[model samples]
Target chain A: SQQGEEDPQALSIQEGENATMNCSYKTSINNLQWYRQNSGRGLVHLILIRSNEREKHSGRLRVTLDTSKKSSSLLITASRAADTASYFCATVGFYNQGGKLIFGQGTELSVKP
Target chain B: EPEVTQTPSHQVTQMGQEVILRCVPISNHLYFYWYRQILGQKVEFLVSFYNNEISEKSEIFDDQFSVERPDGSNFTLKIRSTKLEDSAMYFCASSEMGGSSNQPQHFGDGTRLSIL
Candidate 1:
């Protein structure tokens, strides 16, 4: 897998079911962020987790980071139809001077209501 | 809510022509960035700017590309002598802080550039 690679490129689930997406990177990162993008639209920041953090939560979204493995998972609980969008994990590498975000290919999620 | 707005949502320019894309970041943002996504490709960073100078730029930002905060309010990306490969969706983003990467960046809807 490449740096900032998200598995399960496409995911479809029932409206009320939980959706889980995973991402992996090959380098040390200062922080990682998840973003949502509807088709032909801009990216919307969802959450961020720092290097030292293990777990973080906001609303129905839960993110977990494991520096030892350079992996992270995002879980959207009780997902709604409106939650359907492409989800991408972006990393700010420790050595990135300008804080540029290195993004993954993204997971295209579909919540069937 | 404060938003980063981009002008000329869609642009079509002839090859070898100079083209400029404009962005107005959120009022209080301190750091500004530009990223581009070729159709069906992942978003790629182009440049980051702060305090009127480019802080960092990717290899993709070649000599043909330039950025300017020409006025206090507008940040522009000018591509001198546009090429067909330059046709992509360009996004402008801003963040409140520059010291840390933990701040979430807000992005504009993007300006789609098409070169003929």
Candidate 2:
């Protein structure tokens, strides 16, 4: 079973607008990370928020995590046409063996000019 | 600026035939992983290798899938028998922290495998 799952499988927005994508996971995790994929290409790491951290920011990306809710959200501000891509949330479970990322069904975002 | 690199950007094979997807992770990275994304589906974890052995694998990684770090720089994923359903973009990733909670894994461009 997948540990992380995203909501609103697809999202559409206009350039300069803000887009929010949500994710919910089933297990306790050490961190939650977001990734971006352009078309069928490999994933690009976006941001990672640790369990001890509630939020983080990088450029136009903002990510928030709530361990008690087992949920996280990715917000892209001032979206651009180039921001069009699929977004995925992955969970890094809290374990010593090695943290494995279980990916969620990605949300495809299309930014129209 | 270092990034993961995958060979043979695209590969086509007949069903029941064998195929190997290769990758070279970032230098100085200790952890490696393979994930696949079928058309119109979420990316799925196939396996993770560390210390020259598989530390974890998903259910989707069954008897057909195998991973190897043949040398110091190369990591390979092999499917013994190609199946049409196995067609997907396979991505190789590496991280410096060995899956520590604080680091993010870097990914390769991916190898598109088309099983005929």
Candidate 3:
């Protein structure tokens, strides 16, 4: 089974709008993390929420994890054109070796000026 | 800020040849990892190393693939015999610690491997 899967494969928004991306996983996890990637670049860590934590915020980014539902959401507020990139949710769990991550396919977000 | 560094932004290799990708993780990091992503695909874990040995590896890390920390500063992934499917952007990452510590990983830009 795929460990992580993201929805709304693509999103287009104007600058200043909020962008929300959802991700679901197949099993229990120790922690869930969000990452962003610009075209052809490596991933940049955004935020992480442990199974015990419900929500976390970093600057303009917010992340919420629902263990019961095995789902998570990432919200980018007041987005800018520079924020255009792909966002992914990854998990660490029994299926994943310690420190190893299982990643979602990612949602491509485009913020137009 | 310190960053993980990967060598050769891009590499082209003939199928059946061996290839080695190198990374220099952050100086204080205790855990090291390698991951790959084919074009437009999710990043997949390849293996994780700590204390100079592999602690965990995915199925994709078969006999053909091996990792080593030859020195205090360098970590490497070597594919004995590359295949067309081996082509992908390989990234190296590291963190101060692992598990419940909730340490987010830092990554290198990536090394794009193209197999011919």
Candidate 4:
């Protein structure tokens, strides 16, 4: 079963613009992580934000988690053509054992040059 | 900068036949996992392995599915009888620590399994 559901199923933007994607999960989570997948490829870890943390940043990627609302968001600043890919948000529930992740449907982002 | 690696980027098998997907996780990692994604669908967790044993598995993981470390560096997922619905991209992942540690998982490029 999937715990998260990402909003904005698809987004298109010009290079240098910013892209924001949101995710909402059903249960309390220990951590929320974001990943990117290029076409026909495996997932690439982007960043991880613990439930105790409100926000985190890595390079152009910023992730914010709100446990009270059971939602999280990913913001990619100054997007590039290479940034075109599908982004997913995965959650590890508080009671989940063995760290099994429940992933969201994902948002497909397209950046044009 | 080590990364997980998977073999046979793509595999085509007939229904009812068996298929094996292989992976070599980063050295020194302790936790291993397998996930599958059907085209246009979300990635779904199949199983998690630690201490050379299965620690967790999802409902989708049934009797037809099994995993093994096999050797020091190799992890493999075997399907006894492939079904048409079983066709999907299979990914292998590993982490430096177990789920309680909050460590992120590293994933391989994935094997595209097509059951014809």
lDDT of 3 by residue, B16-73 (tens): 9999999999999999999999987889999999888899998999999999999999
Return the candidate ranking by DockQ, descending.
4, 2, 1, 3
Model 1 residue runs over 4 Å out of place are B99-101
Give me the overall lDDT of model 3. 0.92
Worst 10 residues of 3 chain B by lDDT: B95-104
How does residue B99 of candidate 1 score in lDDT?
29
Candidate 3 off by > 4 Å:
A94-97
Q: What is candidate 1's lDDT per residue for B1-116, written digit by digit as tens?
A: 99999988999999999999999999899899999999988889899999999999989999999999988889999999999999999999999876264789999999999999
TM-score of 1: 0.97
The better candidate by TM-score, 2 or 4, is: 4
Can you give the TM-score per candidate against the true fold? Answer: 0.97, 0.96, 0.97, 0.98
lDDT, candidate 2, A1-113, per-residue tens: 53756888999999999999999998878888999999867899999999889999999999999999999999999999999999999988777356678899989999999
Q: Over 4 Å off in model 2, which ranges?
A: A2-4
lDDT of each: 0.92, 0.90, 0.92, 0.94
For each candidate, what's the DockQ? 0.70, 0.71, 0.68, 0.82
lDDT of 4 by residue, A13-65 (tens): 99999999999999888899999999998899999999899999999999999
Error in Å for residue A34 of model 2: 0.3
Winner by lDDT:
4
Q: Which of candidates 1 and 2 is the stronger one according to lDDT? A: 1
Give the DockQ (C-alpha) for candidate 4: 0.82
Give stretches of model 4 more than 4 Å off: none
